[model samples]
Target: SADETLAHLQAALKRRRRLSDQAQMLVRKAMAYIHSHYTHPLTRQDIAHYVGMSEDYLTHCFRQELGTTPVEYLNRYRVLQARHLLAESDKSITNIALEVGFSSSSYFSRVFRKEVGQSPEEYRRLKQSSVR
Candidate 1:
């Protein structure tokens, strides 16, 4: 009876490890897809389809592996690029927002503020002042 219980536990552990590995691989593929398509307007469904899984499953993998949702990850990447363009180029805030894949400057501002503790305009000004 004890031997049977031990064998069952081992099999369950092996199955869990295999599933974890599979989920990690899926997350990696999803990240790659995000990287390549971050500049385009995308949805969770699109990412899920790209990774050959359901939307819920993809979201779970992202959360489990990266501690973030796919949308947050994409938004962060866009914001990172926007910060660079904001600091280095003379592009208008709206143009920079569009270039960074946000559908509207207003949404971009909200997301940027949430992540950076400031608006995009304020960030650009700060960077400029620091450089000067």
Candidate 2:
């Protein structure tokens, strides 16, 4: 009886691990949508349809695997792109924000500050000062 119980437990554990991997794969696929379309305004429904899953399923996979929602991930990616533009290009903050799919400069600045710990102007000034 003990042997049989151990075998059943092991099988269940293996199944759970396999399901976890599958969920991770789904999350990775969702993340790819951002990478492939970071410059465009993409929606959660768009990503879900692209992956052939419901929006709720995609969101669950993302949160379960990555500990964040799809929008959160997209915001991080957008901020990363903004950082690159700030460092590598002479684009104005508003233009950079719009180009990176943010709806407005104010929202972009808010999210950027939350992630980068500085307003876009401050970030640019700091980086520029370091360069000189």
Candidate 3:
């Protein structure tokens, strides 16, 4: 009974190890693109091309590993950067939007709300309030 239990545990652990390894490789490539060019109006197609896969394939891989598409990931990342600028920089929201790859402030506000549950202005208000 002890030997069987040990074997089962070992098998489970091995499966988890293999899955994590594969997931890490997928995320590593995705993040490489995100970090290097988050400011450059990158697209899912660009990431797919960089990784030598079709856009659909890259989307599937990203969803399997990160539970989201690359575009969603990048959008959230941009919103995060916008949050920082809102809190720390004198830049206007429009300027911050452009800085973070959003082509328009209105569009950035839309996506920011979708990802962050609030408009960028509201996020900044909350952040500023918390700091006081």
Ranking by lDDT: 1, 2, 3
Candidate 3 lands at a TM-score of 0.80
Predict model 3's lDDT versus the native: 0.77
Clashes of 1: 0
Clashing residue pair totals per candidate (backbone < 3 A)? 0, 0, 0
**Winner by TM-score:** 1
Superior candidate under TM-score, 2 versus 3: 2
Better of 2 and 3 by lDDT: 2
Candidate 3: residue 102 lDDT (0-100): 91
Worst 10 residues of 2 by lDDT: 1-10
Residue pairs whose backbone atoms clash in candidate 2:
none
Quick one: RMSD of model 3? 9.3
Off by over 4 Å in 3: 1-26
**Runs in model 1 lying further than 4 Å from the true structure:** 1-19
- What TM-score would each prediction reach against the true structure? 0.84, 0.82, 0.80
Candidate 2 lDDT by residue in tens digits, 1-132: 234234433544454453466666666676777777977888999888887888898887766555567888788889988887898789999999999999999999999999999999999988888888
Report the lDDT tens digits of candidate 3 across residue range 1-132: 234234433544454343455545655666677867888979888888887778887787666655578898788778877888998877889999999999899999999999889988888889888888
